[model samples]
Target: MKAEHQNLYQPHKGGTLCKMLFPVLLLTLFFPLGHAQSSMSPEFSIIKPRHSRLLKSALQRETSAFLLSDPWAPLENQGWRSCVESRNGPALPEKSEGYIQVFLDGGLNQQRMGICDAVAVAKILNATLVIPYLEVNPVWKDSSSFEDIYDVDHFIDVLKDDVSIVKELPEEYSWSTREYYATAIRDNRIKVAPVHASANWYLENVLPVLRSYGVAAISPFSHRLSFDNLPMDIQRLRCKVNFQALTFVPHIRTLGDALISRLRYPQDPLKVTAAGDKEMAGKFVVLHLRFDKDMAAHSACDFGGGKAEKLALAKYRQVIWQGRVLNSQFTDEELRSLGRCPMTPEEVGLLLAALGFDNSTRLYLASHKVYGGEARISTLRELFPLMEDKKNLASSEERSQIKGKASLLAAVDYYVGMHSDIFISASPGNMHNAMVGHRTYLNLKTIKPSMALMGQLFLNKNISWSDFQQSVVEGHQNRQGQIRLRKPKQSIYTYPAPDCMCQA
Candidate 1:
């Protein structure tokens, strides 16, 4: 598994300048209008003729700022809404002989986010209508603007059968997965392409489609795209579009709250819990260790070749496990799995005394080969007499997978969550756990620019896992030392039934 970096901000030199200026402009324009509204609801007075003109200018500026700030906000006071409502549905330009439409399949990620990115390019370039998946049903229903929307019911057939808009796609774009998504873009006469096409391949094959649709430039953030490889002609087209006259001067609206608002689902119960758990809700640091068994995708960067890959995985696993043991307060259940064997009985006795366990921290055994089929349970029972109880031995074996990969990972996560007091994760494979959860410590080896941006965004959310750990280590150290396991908030699971107590 490759290291994953989180990408929060789309890369744009111009966009960065726009972000810095927008807030100041909004603040300057908003204050007076808000004061006037509070002072007089329906009407207000301007002391002088010059003041009246200045007031009108302020109001116009305010309206523009509000529209940009919140596209979803009501635009009744904003003259732009009325302007749009009044304009007759403009006919498609003669040059717009074809179209390039996109439909997102799943939740926001590289794919949907990339498409959203195209919004800026399309607006600036006067490209053919590039509607986002969310905007299919326009919020304001005006006929002229609404005519651009085509019903997607027969979208697949249209892509496969339509000849007017599409041309043959590249061979690599003909894979089954590509065709599956291409169903939406294909025209009867032309073959629509997939997002997976390399930047160069897309520019070569899709430029004609853009020109046919009168689309000079497009935003394509939803895919792994780069302008570095575009053909010289396509670059010239973009330059031309940048200089072309605009029917409407482009305006970008930025809302800091928009992303958070989108995260709230309509069906969400919106539950909030009291701060502390019944028992010391032991901080379970999740360390995800992703070992890619498949050897197919390593042709490009084989510095040490296959030998390097194996070494990387082993080192990664060892580092994560050692970090967890050193940083966290672990129970006997966890220490037994650490594989740090004592050289002698005296050494083992000292280790047990240090742990405050009565010769019960099972001495790590060298002969044990749980990764292969060995009597790990029998070995454990012999080492720790407390496990002589048949029921106890059976339970231990059931909880710990001494052999298989899937089961081992599951057991590790479970044991940490159940018994540890702090957690740190190193895996980039399980995106939800690594990216979305309340993570406190992360052990990522690579620091891509996109990932750095994501880390900044992740910190904005107060409940992230890393934040939780920081609060505990800094503010709650005294509290943890005195902490005792409270009664389980819910019941623990038995052998035949799986545990539901840990469900998030």
Candidate 2:
């Protein structure tokens, strides 16, 4: 059986022709070609020609007993409501102190948090905010600006009452650029703002700069503001920015709506009656597969890729971080026991199967490139044959606007994930953190996976499928969309219970 599995994947070496035949061969091996075609929906049936499908039928048969009668039932939200109350907080000052400029660095979600913190910092210092600058992402090499991904006008208009915001600096402060600050440390440049700096820290360090030069430019400003000890109004303003202010541009939203429409009604329009349309409006689960190469390499845990894979990852780690991976000291077993390893595509597929999702579930994959390419994700495709992603669902013309732009693509995924009936991330990261908070704010259902429990379960090679399914179901009982109140030093973006929510 192992040899057959290895043989099934050998087409990847033969290039395009063999890639096209790979899925056909797998379909023939598992189900007859006609049966495969008839069983698949229009969307799944017409995935890119080169896309491959490989299934291990023995594993599927083992876990088929746990399939639920109603796996699409919505998770409840215990009467919690999103409420940003600043009635007792102080009002905005009549006159702004000066201008505050921030250059944010990181991916979409990290920069998103930085943007909110920039707004709060502006409010704290009573300064007018110049639009935060989004640095070019090093990994994706995307040069998309803030306006390219978000609705700038909407962002400005939504926060107009809370804090002052401007698209550009005034003529007097126009000379303040990122290059200017990098060349030399001017009086107005703040290059040393601490991570999670307190409001008082900003007042002392930045307010003086603002008063001295009438402006302050903060570079590398991701996570520069603290989450704790802020005033009630400041915290509420952060919540408002995250939940109400940030909206995607028109094109991204249009594409997102189109994708959502297709996911709900995948059949051809000519075959549909009104009743059939109602019945076919299916609910989808958006699985944010955060299993890219950077994550896999940085985890420093072996993924059964053999010695060559291990050597490649080690070299990658050295090149990326100069071999500073802190988890490298631990053995793979120790790391898995500590829940520090990233889950692979196959592992996450088994997780979904154990959680009662069957082959019929419409799984929308919200991800970038998986590490090992098509061969790596073959098991996941087999587990949920009805799965779809941006590339498969959107036409080349339809997705042209966001094709190579990572930030824009992420924004589209964010929009679609927001509209999904249920959202889950294979492993927790920035995207997962952002979605969990946003879904909680909207009272939508989101499954937070227990990484430690899952790690331990997969380690037990002799465990039965029934026992694994029961453990997963029991472990996740209280984790689905439950409100976790913010503790000291906890991010309001992730745990927005008392700060951003009100109990009914």
Candidate 3:
């Protein structure tokens, strides 16, 4: 009975040899099946791009051991220091040296403007510029890494000999996460460079690339992160070569140029105009409490405080009304309750009425309805409690001019171009600020900074609305001499605007 169970292999062969041979045959037959069924995890398998040679060393047996065991281990290269050493001087004879590129990763949609200020700075420095779009692919089920989004070889090919690409990781602690994308870039398989996250990352990744290539300094923006505090490196680099920081402002250049072009051609309904002395109908000051619903996530760089709703009435008052304010949740009554001096709707109404063009002045309250900004209609009611009675202020007909977010922002480029005054912007990150500032600068009009600090903390040292007001007046006066007063460096005027269609 036991003999009947085995049969085939043990029936007539050498027992030990048959056992070994059978096991080998079974393994051979099932090996492909096991491999076919196996799958990589979502994070790694998804978004897998075509093979990259650079990626070889990153995942190879020995290098991967180092990566897993000691990601921070120093490589045998001079690091970013060499590249920094190369950029010092007067424009590098335009063609004498290679190109350096600073890549802004995860730059999707309107957020691409963050790189605007930086890109404008780049053109001034003569660096070859490239912006790889990291768009997510819907068809691919797996998570797409940065490698899948951008063509690395194509990116490198565009660069001049000595230059390298530096990825600007989004801020730490802020919810805007771009670390995964940056990691993919660093994980180029071949271990040719160091992978990094910040200036320190640059020292690890960029420095190694340059050192290996025997080049010096990458053309980057202000080296404050790398050498500003460390005088020794700066001094050492200073002696070696022109280790200077170059500003790239292409983003700014394009936006500014687009605004200027539209102004130059009025027939284009899609274009924006410069701020004019005459206010347009519904010329309201639009402030953002929350940029869409994700306000809590992306801290307000323009709102002054980290959170928008918590901004004190005092801080709110600091934003002088250049035009009619569609009502914010921060009403005059609320301001008074908070022990902050309040500006009445009558006062706001009076300012609008007194305006050289009241009927033409349109106020807009733009924010997601969920964020709790008073509706434009109700806001108008508060601004003119007696809209039902003209004796108190402007006639009801006059107050009906304000618009809401959808309508207002749709034609923001227009209002900003034709009628807006120094649009008291909330922050640079907002779509409003990008369009308004870009358009304002294109017309060569004086575009001033927001009264609100870059973040709430930016107001800490400069607290007290009184002091803040004084600073606003004083700062503008100072900048007038710089950004506004100068002969307008044509260099500063050439940033590109975002495709207006995207704004649509």
Candidate 4:
């Protein structure tokens, strides 16, 4: 049997198959020859693929007998209700000697994470946050303004008690840009910036700036705050910041409501009768297919589309992403097997299908204009033909309103993902990390990838589809949006646990 087809599992030492199987087989001797031969055919064969020793045992977990969902069914735990009930943020102090205010400026994901940090910093310093300046992502050239996407008025009103916030810098723009101190941008192997200073540094250095200049401007503030050994209250403030403060703007939200309504009744009787479709489809999974051009160029993976493609990606990676990677350091084969970069569409398709998602399963792909367009998408589409995107789901008129606005389109995907039945990501990228916090805050099911384990399995060509699927299924069965109470700063899956979950 081909490795890609069989249900064989890699041999983990001291095989756990029941010894009684042989004895049961003895009874089969009395049966018809046809029945016994059934096991000999390809379908029931137990042969492990060649060249495979057990890579770590696939995530070993028992099947859950009871459903772990709430009464609302798929809307099991929404953030609106779940978060409002959280005591995750510390009680507000009665008095403050002065206020620490900051201006946030970064790319979309950076700004999202920066909001979490800014709220934490505000609580840590007991400062009020000026409405952040949402900078256009230079790389993306998106034109949507912050107010156009998020409700600034609602954002301030909701968090007014926990931390004071204003829309835009309260004073002249020069006050923010001129008399401010900015933290040095930091980076590490994982792209998560390391802590630049201790709490004392904020108290002594950053605080004085607030005192000296009523407003302090913190550029590239995402991932700037560290959770290392901080006081419990400080950590809680971080959660409060992430869950409570960063509400979407009203414009994006109305569209979100429409999307949610569609999900709730995909086959409305009235609409269906008009459109010639009555089949109801609900509960989709979101794939943050982070394989757009920028990502591929940034990673420099170059999965070899002949000589020209390889050289182009190699050169592209060199141009941006700083000096984090170099083409000469790794080969095409090494890059693919090492899992050092994003998975190819074919690879993702194979992975999803092998893990039991039927080809007919509806996958809501949350992505921008994928780099290679339909050609790249067709790779995964062939495997899961029922795939849909914003283009497929929304009307031409609906899409035209946000046409050419990259950030608004992203907002569409973000909101849809937040409400999905299950959210699965390709890697620990921004989309995955942000949703981990967002969905986790809502107690929604998230299939967080264990990259190291996945890489080991993905690279092992000898593993059969059945074995690969079973291992993946068992490995991840326990991680159905289970709370990650405490984890390292770099680990994106548990990123929200510090702020979103309580002891209850």
Pairs clashing within candidate 2: none
Question: Residue-wise lDDT of candidate 1 within 39-63, one digit each (tens)?
Answer: 1111112111211232232223222
Residue 170 deviation, candidate 4, in Å? Answer: 4.7
- Tens-digit per-residue lDDT, 296-329, candidate 3: 2122122212233333222222222211233444
Off by more than 4 A, model 4: 1-105, 168-196, 260-266, 269-281, 302-304, 321-328, 458-462, 488-494
The C-alpha local distance difference test score for the whole of candidate 3 amounts to 0.29
lDDT of each: 0.26, 0.80, 0.29, 0.58
TM-score of every candidate relative to the true structure: 0.23, 0.86, 0.32, 0.72
Residue pairs that clash (backbone atoms under 3 angstroms), model 4: 59-475, 100-127, 150-249, 151-249, 239-499
lDDT of 2 by residue, 273-321 (tens): 3674666677889999897767887899887666656665665555445
Please state the error at residue 410 of candidate 1 in Å: 14
TM-score of 4: 0.72
Alpha-carbon lDDT of model 4: 0.58
| Error of model 1, residue 162, in angstroms | 30
Error of 3 at 264 (Å): 14
